[model samples]
Target: MASLSFVNVCKTYKNGLTVVKDFNLDIKDREFLILVGPSGCGKSMTLRMIAGLEDITSGELWIDGQLMNMTSPQSRDLSMVFQSYALYPHLTVYQNMAFGLKVHKVPKDEIEKRVGRAAEILHISHLLDRKPSALSGGQKQRVAIGSVIVRQPKAYLMDEPLSNLDAKLRSQMRVELAKIHRELGATIIYVTHDQVEAMTLGTRIVVMNSGVIQQAASPNDIYENPVNKFVAGFIGSPSMNFFPVWVARRGEKICLEFGKNKLIANEICSKRLVEDGYVGRRVYLGIRPEDFHEEGPEEQKILFDVEMKEVLGAEILFHGRINREEICVRLSPNVKAEPGERLPVYVDMDRIKLFDMDTEQNIIYV
Candidate 1:
């Protein structure tokens, strides 16, 4: 229900350590935007700035067309949920959820109506009489969220709200959060270090590193067309495999050669390499684990020395070496292969990515 804009925003400490560098982004109304990166990557710091918990060193912070850089947290009219539940231990679920409205002196009947609606939306109606001590971890989290829901703020800010729960609870909460987003149609800004959460929950993802924005795109674009080596290696589960290979011309064909092996490039990749005059130079060959296939043209096969295997239900991940460089391949579970065996696999030419050796940027996208 609200839109936010950060125009050339920055955050720096008194000790002169800058955490956010010229950050600029526009968040649309009713959007679920995720800020994702590793620890100390400025994701949480960015969220704090929006919540009025941190001062912006420079630039503008606007909310629904109002300048908010000088605004107090209370006047921001935004609700924030933290990793800790922070519920009052002595208050019942209904009382805890109604506390905020009571402090603001809302009508008693109106408070009751809001609490009932929130509890129903969160599926915690039956637990309204229970105290924080008697609720499960997930239920406690729901109560914390319900407290914010009653406020009905313009936007919601969440900083890893599900991180404190167990893995199973985290997965369950993920589904619950998705449903809440749809039902409320409220704008949400979420921050987390978990890529799975970023991929599944976000309508738009912003990837950051060292106080800089690396890439901002949808899940499919980030997975299929990463902007650089760091993103290509970070977004996926098993991560993309990298190899130092030479781009060379062999007769009338363009091929990538590493050690004693060679693989042909698809027409699109080959055209870029030649047009960019990289005929005889070193480049990084990037391939995802799932792009390796057990069936392909015989001439495109390479001997992969399997060192270990992990069976993950529907598929198997083979951790092996190709010409002394470590590699991981995800294949169908039906494919039979064992440790210490030479297994031949082919790379999907059309699905492969190439990166610049010096700049580390994706060559195809550059």
Candidate 2:
């Protein structure tokens, strides 16, 4: 419902500790923007700054074209949902959902209408008369979200609101939150350490690390074309595998060499390596777990000494050594494999990524 812009925002505490550095981002109206990283990466601090809960040490925060540096939390027209479902334990679901509206002295009929609509949207209409102690974890979370929805704020700020739920419930709520976003058309700024949540929920994801914005883009772009090694390693589930290899030229062909193994570089990678003068230099070779295949060209195959295996329903994860470097490979469950076995696996050369050894930046993308 509103656009938010952070222009060179930085937050430093009195102890001289800076958690967010030179942060700049523009959140579009009706956009589900996610701020995601490891703990202490300044994602929550950024969200708090937007809610006027934290003071901006420097730079500007503009909400819908108005400077809101000194605005109070209540005056900011933003609602925040925390990890802990901060519900009035003694109050019924209906009362908890209606509390904010009643505080503003909204008409009795209007409060009922808003609460009813929110309850229906959250699929918690049947539990309206129940108190917090009587509802399940998922139900209580829905009530917490329902409370915020009734406010009809300009944007919703969520700081890992689903983190408290169990794994199964968390999965269920992810779907619900996506549905709510579509129905309300509300602008939401969500902060989380869970990359899965960031990938599934956000229309755009901002990957941060140690106070800096690493990469901000659509989920597909960030996954397929990461700006650097940190973003690439952090966004994926199994994490991308990296190997330090020398870029070598065998006449017209370019290859990545590590230990006794070699992978022929694709045409694009070969040209970049040659033109960039990386031949015979060491760089990090990145490959996702899914990129390894059980079959391929004989020359492209490498020996994988499997040390461990994980059978995850539809797929199996082989953890072992390839070219003397530890790596993980995801394969269909239809394939049979066991520990202490040496298997030949092929890598998808076109999907491999090369990173500068010193800077750890993706060569092709950066």
Candidate 3:
């Protein structure tokens, strides 16, 4: 296992279009870090740079304590499992797993021992003699992972390795991959555009955009307190509802006005936002689907008319509009809802986020 670091990493194609901008992150040994972003957002390019498949335009990449700016991919002591399971069509599973070692002229007995153990770990021992054509997509994926496992490198780099499977199989493999990581204690860097995969598989996640690092933190932290509007909307399903609001002095108390309602901000939000040179200026009220509740007794939550409800398994997502601004609430599955109807929804005062409309920076409550 090894720690990986990228210091001031940058990547530019031949057209001089920059894909990464002073990207920096520290991945601890044995840590499962995920790089998540929309496609063409430099996540794959960053991984390729680490794997030495693409040369770094500038800056250094490090593994453990070694400077690997010019190191060959093979000398990086890492293994990669890609989206397509590149298993040999003619070779049996055992042979495909052992091919790397065989090419290096590793002893035949040692190769068998490593392959056997990996197959057992991956639970593919029974299918060792099967050809890739004979295996299910999931089984083939497991074999691809097992092929890497047998090598037992310092770290593993996976680029959307489970993307090709069905949802059920992807769910199953998520568990298996976690188990494999724990059992082997190998560091792993995974890249995926799927937020669910990033949230579930990563101990820490780095969210990127436009070739820049937006936020890097644990899943829980990023979910609960995203650094900006992009991270806030990108990390959650159904996305967060954003609407324009203006801070105003109504009567005597300071409040944020949305449409016809004067929703009071938390004292912290009011203080930071009011003093951040934007008091009485336009800002965006950030609210998550789950943050809005059907019952709100507080004097602060904005009221809305129910527009629609999407029942997802055990939870219901209530879509509403307040002063023409769209809103959402996560309700229990038992709560019956209808569209174009008036329903009282509460915006959790303590769970609110305020972002500068122009800068998109979180107006951190002091």
Candidate 4:
């Protein structure tokens, strides 16, 4: 395993379009780091730069403390697994896994040993004699991974390697990846647009957008305390609900008003707003779908006209409107809900998030 670092790295096209801006990160040895974002968000561009497939407009790339800004991809001591399983259809699984070693003229015995070990680790030992055409999608993927495993490179770069699999197979491959990481202790850099994959597979995640790094932290930290509105909305399923709210101070108490409902701001939120001199200022109120409950005290309740109901097993997502703003509430499967009806939903005050209206930044969390 090896440590990787991107120091003030950047990528700009000849036409003057900058895709990655002053990118900086420190990847520890054996760390499984994930680059996650929406499409066209520079996640793939960053990976390409690291793999030496693209030129860096400026800055440095380091691997194990060696400067690799101008190093060729072949000399980078890294292996990349592409989104498509790039296996030779004519070769058997064992031959495909051993191709790289043979090209480098490694001893025949050594190649066989490495191929056998990788197949065993990936649990594909039974399919070694089968050609690529005879293998399933998952099996082909494993062969692609095994092809790199035999090289014993310093790090592994996987760009959406599980994207083409079916949903159930993708879920299975996630577990297999974690197992592979444990057994090999290989440093890995993974890129994907799937938030669930990012949350489950990455030891640390870097959230990116429009050529900028928004947040880089553990999955739990990013989920509970996103740095900005984009990170908050992107990380959660069904997305967090946002409402235009006005902050007003009444008799030494700070309160938030949305529509016809008002709730006292928690101590942390109140203190931040007060210090920022935001009394009577409009801000965005952020809350997760799951944080809205069907049962609570009347003081915490807010009424909304349910517009749509989506039934998901074990839970239901209720879509409603409040003061012309759409919001979704996740409730228990047992809760009775219907469209075109008014419902009193309670906000979990302890889990509330507040963001600045103009900046869209989390006030308390930041």
The TM-score of candidate 3 is 0.95
Clashes in each model (backbone N, CA, C under 3 Å)?
A: 0, 0, 0, 0
Cα lDDT of model 1 by residue, 174-244, tens digit: 99889999989989999998899999999989899888888989888998899999889989999999999
| Number of the top TM-score candidate | 2
Q: Any idea what lDDT model 4 has?
A: 0.92
Model 1: residues >4 Å from true position, as ranges?
A: none
lDDT of each: 0.92, 0.93, 0.88, 0.92
Candidate 1 weakest lDDT stretch, 10 residues? 295-304
**Per-prediction TM-score, please?**
0.96, 0.98, 0.95, 0.97
The residue pairs in collision within model 2 are none
Candidates 2 and 4 compared: the better one by TM-score is: 2
- Model 4 pairs whose backbones collide: none
lDDT of 1: 0.92
Alpha carbon deviation, residue 132, candidate 3 (Å): 0.7
